[model samples]
Target chain A: MTQHTQPSAKALVPFVSVDNMMRLIHHVGLEQMLRDLAGYVEDDFKRWELFDKTPRVASHSDVGVIELMPTSDGESYGFKYVNGHPKNTSEGLQTVTAFGLLADVYTGYPVLLTEMTILTALRTAATSAMVAKYLAPKGATTMAMIGNGAQSEFQSLAMKAICGITSVRLYDKDPAATAKCAANLAGTGLNVVICTSPEQAIEGAQILTTCTADKQSATILSDNMVGAGVHINAIGGDCPGKTELAAGILSRSDVFVEFPPQTRVEGEIQQMPEDFPVTELWQVITGAKTGRSSAEQITLFDSVGFAIEDFSALRYVRDHIKGSDFFFELDMLADPDDPRDLFGMVQRAAR
Target chain B: MTQHTQPSAKALVPFVSVDNMMRLIHHVGLEQMLRDLAGYVEDDFKRWELFDKTPRVASHSDVGVIELMPTSDGESYGFKYVNGHPKNTSEGLQTVTAFGLLADVYTGYPVLLTEMTILTALRTAATSAMVAKYLAPKGATTMAMIGNGAQSEFQSLAMKAICGITSVRLYDKDPAATAKCAANLAGTGLNVVICTSPEQAIEGAQILTTCTADKQSATILSDNMVGAGVHINAIGGDCPGKTELAAGILSRSDVFVEFPPQTRVEGEIQQMPEDFPVTELWQVITGAKTGRSSAEQITLFDSVGFAIEDFSALRYVRDHIKGSDFFFELDMLADPDDPRDLFGMVQRAAR
Candidate 1:
């Protein structure tokens, strides 16, 4: 393991672990990173046509699902391997864990590999706020965050950074989760309110976010709870048969989604019929479609998360970690002196 | 960088780099390792029904194709990221590169990550020899290895270890390739014969292995060149529109394949009609179907490489590297002291 015994340049890949990712976020300031990631997500969304898109390939077991989300922009390729098992938290494991890789399409060589568990949180929140930037009611100042978990603080901070939301009202079924979220957001420049009920949380809020992590379709917000002129960011209902809002709420709102094909299956729109109309968020970002037409029009950003966001997140990390002590080189590829004489490389390495 | 800052057990993943893979292969002896890997491949094939199978998810660009081959037993999941760009060798790069991961199904924790560029060569050869054990002509002693490249030496050694082949006649379109193959196999004990043409290479040989790296449907061996009572191991024609053997040879032979759906699209059988008949190699290994019915009945093992083979290879590496100094720990996962408090873990790391 001497410094002189380093892997060849072709064999090395830059890798960011969770510890480094955390440090990177803190070094850049969490709010600034969220703002920076939102800009990247928006840029990718604006040029979404250049991306090779596919529905996330998922393998579902009885308890959870493992998925591979891959996309490319002709120059570079990225894919994320993520799993979700709500039951994992009960066993003292995270319900969601992920890792991703970015590769050069020209040579098919991996350039960067990083842990995406923390990055997914940042990107998911940034994506929600990005879509909300285009679809939220103008001059929005408050958001009701129903699920107070690992994502609640990030979502609130992202909204504050991107959409100028000054306050977030938090409510979770578990009082301890609300306590944790409230405690985390204490000095994040967001006025936080701890509410006992979902009904109270959404009171006088112009933006309502539902991020309850449940595998089944439990109505966190029934139809009556959703009012007009508010942007509802539904973040937790990302799997089939799992959703946050009631069908009636979706029926009344002008639903905007990242990808219709995916949102119809995994987003809150899954409650609607297959023919139900939803606007693609990219169109709004590209100015191809209208976001919120009138002051009283209800708009819902059905954020199920997509590969492009992860692609942009990986791209951002790949660029941001440069000249920074956030990533190390991993000797992941085999680069023989003579590529064809791989056996000879092995023989020589033995000596 | 402090010695006290060790990653938690849950966050640590075993990583086998390219250098370590080469060392591990030499430590176990290449021929014995090939024989051992063949045993694992055969065992997985026997219980193939227990695996979650899917056609490989592929993204094909104009230059090359990148694929994710994923499969899982109920307890563990494995996937290999592989790329194929036939023109890469011209630029002093390997045409194919790969890495893989094995994760626990229950906790979604990565158990092992390794460079598969070398393991792939070993597993591909072992798989060929394993199929040959079930399908090759009995008392086979000489193998005609056409298209001597990175895979040639491994394939020759595997045939010798698993099927009692004592000699190999090597020929490639390029004489330098044959010379390189012969030089690499000098001390391997298989009497090597350097031939000037494919016709001369096949003389007095019972196994014909074609592993040319052309990305087109070039017939390395035409119908006239392939004879009776020989097992044709076509390894190079693995993508769509790529085939090593002529169509007439496949029509005349009892073609056996790793996975019928995939082989019909990527194997030598891709040249045949959609409904062309072929037997699954697993069925032959499990005795559900017959292999090598008569000495004169030409048998074709159309191997396009399946996820199950990579799954078995990763499994073998995971088991074989135990208590061996071939791997080190990678802090790839973010294991917060409180799983729900991932943000809190990041917050504490700053202090």
Candidate 2:
């Protein structure tokens, strides 16, 4: 709306490039980024009722999936399009990648375009850690990390920052992935142990994390593998027909979710009934409900990654980054001396 | 996909901007762009059965409309979000502005982000003219244009190109718009006559084009003003309750629509019955059905604008524009070397 004195949010748009974001990560250590992002994600989730919500619109393909997750609060609007292709790794590609838009709701003009690939990992870990903060027992020092792949280190770092996790037992089908995770966490001050199986990883670990990327239903955590007073953070089984926990694991826990309508179809709770009683975490954060009845209660945080987390991540990036050289300046918004003269723009540009 | 050694249509994704598009316009001329785009739109319509079509998903606001119109052909996919706020003109903004995404259906990856603000104007004109090519009478020479605002010139140019319109009668509630339309058509070799009233504009004209931008159900064309053998190109009355034509005008005409389901909701036929008989223009273009039946038949092209037209415009731009350091290189797709190592990208970038 440059043509008139209309309200514009152009000044708030943060343009963070992949390289610039990489630089930002280096300047601020990975541990700090994960912890800070978790704080932001948690703070936003606590006030979740103030925001608008919607189920994601997904366009799925046999090889991959692309989705548009949009939400607004009558002030700002954000949407993320992410893709997941389990077999992309065989072709030397990342199985999940994303980009997002942050716009001003008042003007309906996009103010930011960000590479959310790295940010998604950070936010996912932060969200999991936040859930653990409320549900996990005090002095929880050891975490069982199933799927020691791309998301393993973030989980370990967040738990260490928020839940005082000083030790981690990691297990994955690919031993190389576990080895990589161990090496990455070596200087981070956490004691990492490579376990042979999910059972071995769960031994004496108070917090269990399942972040596998299998496209089909596979029980990484069964009832036998879980224990009392342990909080389960299930991450990887995010779409229909894809799940991690066994039915027995879900049947024995006080399940909690971000948005119930979507979680029922895509969360680990997809194995459960339609009338399943699950708590929206916002209520817990807002003190309207409780996260754990007691330390002995089995609390399962069904983490299917909601749109609100992305909104918070985008807000965090916009707030933390200030240098403007890394962003693309767009003429996407149409400006006429008069809004009625849109046709005049083409004519002028033609000249 | 550009990483592939062997080239395929799926491998080359084009990203065109307003600047790049203007260069295309300057090189090929607007008339040719309209003509070529019309052929492209017609060609796509002929293959209508190959498409995956749906009515646009709209998010409405008090001031304007923002929508996502998505369609696919199992190979390529496209979506566009455009807003229209007629009162936005006094603030020096265009009543309608838009941008859209073109993606690969096989990978569900966004392949292009083109400026549909300008492209929409082009496609709207082309579709109107192409429909006129099929439905307007033989040797149609004059067009009466009501509500000569943003879309007025497209109507004039399209009718001039396809239906051999040599003279146009123009009237708008606002006089400056008519002046602007007259200035844009200068030296275009068509006779442009400014009429003070809608009745004066429709005098003995073979084609009547209505492109108003009112938000109410204001009748701009009465039944008595429209006679037999007069093809009406209804361009503006798209959203609910914003129609320009009286129901009597639609009742007397054989309606041709882009998609019947959508046209029934957003076109002039919104006030009509659910069982109202209408022909999908694509069927008529493919000769699976009929267009103008006889010399006395009146045809109405209910042009609410569709996504396939944007797909065709993007395809045309992709074919015409070569990236020799004159385009926006968007990060619409992820090209990770090892898809499984998504976390490593952040780590490596941190380095």
Candidate 1 per-residue lDDT over residues B1-351, each given as its tens digit: 411234588888899988888778878888899999999999999999999998898988888999999999989999999999888888888888999999998877789999999899999999999999988888999999999889999999999999999999999999999999999999989999999999999999999999998888798999998888999999998999888888999999999988888888898988888999999888998899999999999999998999999999999999988998889988788888777787877777777
For residues B1-351, what per-residue lDDT tens digits would candidate 2 score against the true structure?
012122223223355656566666757888888999999998999898988777776666676666667777667767776767666666555567677777666555567766677788889989999999999988899999887777788778877877789999989988988888888788888899999999999998998999888788878998898888989999988987789899998898999999888889999999899999999998899999989989888899888988788788877766676654335565434344445555665566543
What is the Å distance of residue A114 in model 1 from its true position?
0.3
Could you tell me the interface RMSD of model 1? 2.1
First chain TM-score for all predictions? 0.98, 0.93
Task: Give the per-residue lDDT digits (tens) of candidate 1, residues A281-326.
Answer: 8899999999999989999988899999999999999999998888
RMSD of each: 1.5, 4.3
Candidate 2 on A1-351: residue-level lDDT in tens? 012122233322344655556666667777788888988888888779878788887766677676777777667677777777777667555677677777656556667767787788888998898889888877889999999878898889889987789999999989998988888788888999999999999999889999899889998987787889898999998999899999998888999999999999999989998998899998998899988888788899998999999999988777776553445555555565555555665667655
Report the error of model 2 at residue A173, Å: 0.4
The best candidate in terms of DockQ: 1
Per-model fnat list: 0.58, 0.44
Off by over 4 Å in 2: A1-14, A322-324, B1-14, B323-326, B331-335
Give the top-scoring candidate (TM-score): 1
